[model samples]
Target chain A: MRKLALICVVMVLAFLPPPLLGEVDSALLQDSVTVDLPEPPAPPGNVTATDNPNDNGRAIRVTWELSADDTTGMKNVIGYRINRAEARDAADSLWTEASDILPSGTTEFIHSGDGEEDGPDYFAKNYDFYYRVHALTADTFSVSAVVGPVQAKDNWYNTGVTFVLLFVALFIILTVTFVRIARKGKELYIRPLAGIEAVDEAIGRATEMGKPTLYILGLGSAADIATIASFAILSRVAKKVAEYQTPLLVPCYEPFVMTVAQDTVRAAYMDAGRPDDYDEDSVYFVTSSQFAYVAGVMGTMIREKPATNFYLGMFHAESLLLAETGAMIGSIQIAGTDQIAQLPFFVVACDYTLIGEELYAASVYLSREPVLLGTIKAQDWAKAVVVGTILAGLLARLLVDLDFIKTVFEVSV
Target chain B: MKRQIPMMILSTIGTIFVLAYFSPGLEELEKGGSIFFDVVACFAFFLGGSNLVRVHIQKIARHNPGWGYSIVTLFGFGLMLFIGLFKLGNPLGIAGAPTEPGSWFQIIFQYCVAPLSATMYSLLAFFVASASYRAFRAKNTEATILLVAAFIILLGRTQLGLVMTSWVPDWLSIAQIPNLAVFIMTSPNLAGQRAIMIGIALGVVSMSLRLILGIERSYLGSDS
Candidate 1:
């Protein structure tokens, strides 16, 4: 019986699977021996996630310090991996990989969120976002403690331009106050502009020569401030032409401007007590095409040989062409434009030129109206304030390292 | 009623736009205002086109002194309008862009109008030369200074300034012609430009206020 039982045990042992037979040997080896492995890289330090300021609130800025072991002893670290999760999710929630392989030594990453309504990667504004940085190696990764709950939100007011806003408010108040004072029959003084004085002489010269006075209102629409200012000067010139009985030719580049010019000329004629002399055909629309209008004006100058030419309002490349043609025709030319680039052309080609603000000042100077004169006074005061601020800023920068004064002038929006 | 109503509307719209500029929340209102102006201007183009046609036709009918030129103007205007409006010769028909490739409107614009505009633009070079000759005359102290500045600017823009100043030592680099030209442009020139810009800004502010307050009404052709 003993022999038979031993035989059965031996047979069972022989028939067992190889893995089951090897399990006892593997357990013994694990207990007896241990393999050496390198330690994982240290996690990044001082991780921060914050909303990027002064923006439309579509981004979060993530920053972190390098791990201690990254570039030192062991030096197993290769790069970094950035992970993000919504703050509203669970503490152990699954994180989305924002970047898998940020290069070594990177300390900052700006995670821009799409603001478009239909964008696939759209990130909701004002929602808190959590961020984590992982120090990565060939074999292992060590993640930093999650830096969290930063929400991006839009600011209604850009506090950066507070200084500009205050200055503008002050200027408006000063101008309105002066306008009201002038309306109460108060006389205000404005220095005469040489360009304004030259207008009458140019028109008178045309009268003496028995030739027409050509006025070009430029290519700007009636909504343009320069064009509006030109209308004021045109009113004065039209009145003078009517009184002198000299033929006036006003060619307009814009339709609305033509309508405005016609009304201004007719009013000026009536003001001069020569309503019968006003001709509707005098003020008319030329072609709206820039060069086409230039060609037509050049043709008129060549054919009619106007004695006096007045070029005013906003001008572009056409400025030199008109001024040169007028100069060639031996016409006494007076040009005024607010375009800084075109001013040089006018100055070189025309007899008298209004430089920058002089175009705006010319109208008030020509009319000598108390209300307009008051605005000029207000402008002078504003200019003084600007000059004072500039001087103060210069002094402050030279004397100290503080940037408060400079910041006041730095308009961000 | 005619003058007062327009002035009131101008003032109200102008004030609203000014307010919208400073407030970021009201940015949409600013955009709306701009769109409104563009729409109005588009409609105004019809008025301008009709007036252009009417004036030229009158000159043609009366056999005016420039009647020959009027005929050319009318023909060009009519041709452009017909081609552009119908999108003639466009592969995709009227639904296609007026300036689409191979279209009659595109061909005319590219071959005819473009070259004509370019010719006009090129004439600026001759005008510049003539104007510069007259302006650079050293008749006075300021004119002499201006002439010197112009010469420096012109030379600095070319390789001549660098070749001429190559002999200068590094220690006195500021004395080099090109360096001097740069100094003039970045310092004194920038300062003058800024001053002029500031003056312009203040003038615009005052002028805008006058218009908004109804203080300046000569633009409406009403002295009162």
Candidate 2:
């Protein structure tokens, strides 16, 4: 009985320090060090939040001002610690946990529990929540003031502004440029894109030979933009196949891309008014393992014996294997990729090849969706700006090194 | 409608994040966006892991080809989970902590998983050699130019370039083929790469904007 009593006493003693010795009083017990917390910066202009559409109680979005104090540099200011709480309570009141914490220079937060639903508990039951943000130092010893109680706002800006601006800019530039070229009677020169021009020819050859057109969408995910661009090219090819009444076989490496490609081909067929001819089974997943996927594609090329093959999207080492296999099968392969290393193989093995940016440009060239076309043209403008900047900067460097220019433009250091 | 809503959300969020990069006030929105992505990707890993298990289990049940490999995979999966969860063979014992490197899970990861992955990666060297031999042939002007460039780069990466080019005069230092190769790579090649990269970036931006505005419905398997 005495031994049992002694054991109980020891257990109580072990947990005694955990209870209120006023939560261990780390701050109080430590000598009042001369620690100074940088003052909390002002909240961003137009801070707003709204009920996350298609998400549970997690309101979305908050914006704030980056501190002007550290505009020159943020050596001391590490980041901001954003906190949330019920608006009805005081700032000091045990606040609800922060929805998100961001860097000191950051000014917005999009709080949504959509993907995080199965992960962390990010949402709260009460909609009446307020927000506050504090600056944190590099040492993580200091915190700043709380700013909040801003109600959720759902007002949206007129999105037509973007379209109007784009349309006006694109129309003016393209029309003027083409008109000038026409006036000059200088043939607006376009070097032959072997891949683009040969596309139809390859399909025609396949039709003549009574062989299927092979389409290999590389082992990249649907989320990859390159994969999307490849699908665009695939759409064009599929339509041609429908017109020729030639069989089109698309082998996909990703399950998600498989689903997307099937839909894309189906849509292309429907648009071509040959919906009944669309072969959904033609676009199917061929394992996710990169090498295995390549092997499957190679097998398809050998067995199915496609006369014309299109290997498109981001390729890796498998590019050579697929291209070589297609070449051996006597398929007139027209391959396109943004992957630079694979360009050489495609060029060597394929009849026509699209390299680098040409892959992305191919979709815009084919579809000519006014919006897509406009976007492509707009991108050209951005490219021009970069090119022009570099040229001008180099010229200026060669001529005279201006002080103001040096302050603003010097970036290498 | 189901797909439309998600597409709309994606477009809006993606656009907002892009804008946040430029505008100082919208910075928090971007941070939140990154956090959201991290959270989403993390959760999606679970989905991927579950799918992996499901596919293998189905294969085993069906007595499919490579079913033994599936069994091995599942065994590995279950064993790793058990070892990590229980912290088996931990020096600290059950009362202390997990993930202390002395644990069996850590041991297995260091001994088995890391080495296997590294070995697989090292196979790329052999593959590259084979690929180069098959792919590189001076068939035409373009091929010859590529071949020359390839030779220069390959030689420049080795000590042979130094030994071969040591006779080059100091005043005509750029005449050294290896140095010229380096210059070419850093100048013309980098410039071309940068230009293409810029175009790609802009293309991504435009495509993102389209997706954000719900203008690109092809991804959703819908016209509207």
lDDT of each: 0.84, 0.67
Scored by DockQ, the top model is 1
The candidates score, on chain A by TM-score, as follows: 0.66, 0.56
The best candidate in terms of TM-score: 1
- Cα lDDT tens digits for candidate 2, A1-413: 96576556545554776565455435533322323333443333344444433222345565666654435444455566566666635656667556445665787776544225466654543446666655555554233344455433322332323443454355346534543544555443333466788888999999999999998888777667778878878888888899899998887776667766877898778767899998666776555667656655666687679999998898988887788778777899888887777777777677888876677767656654555555555556666766786788777877897665544443220
Model 1 lDDT tens row, A1-413: 96576556556656888787665445433433333344678899999998875555667788999887778756778999888888635465578877758877788887766655798667668987899999988877798989889887655566777787899888877777787888998887767677788888888899999999999999999889889889988988898999999999888898888878988999889888999999887887787889988989998888789999999899999999999999999999999888888888998999999877888787788778877887888898889999998888888899985777766678877
Q: Which 10-residue window in model 1 chain A sums to the lowest lDDT? A: A28-37
DockQ measured for candidate 1? 0.47
- For B21-85, candidate 2 gives per-residue lDDT tens digits of 33333544766876776666455445445655776687689986557766877788789878877
Residue pairs in clash, model 1: none
Which regions of candidate 2 fall more than 4 Å away from where they truly are? Answer: A1-191, A367-382, A403-413, B1-140, B205-224
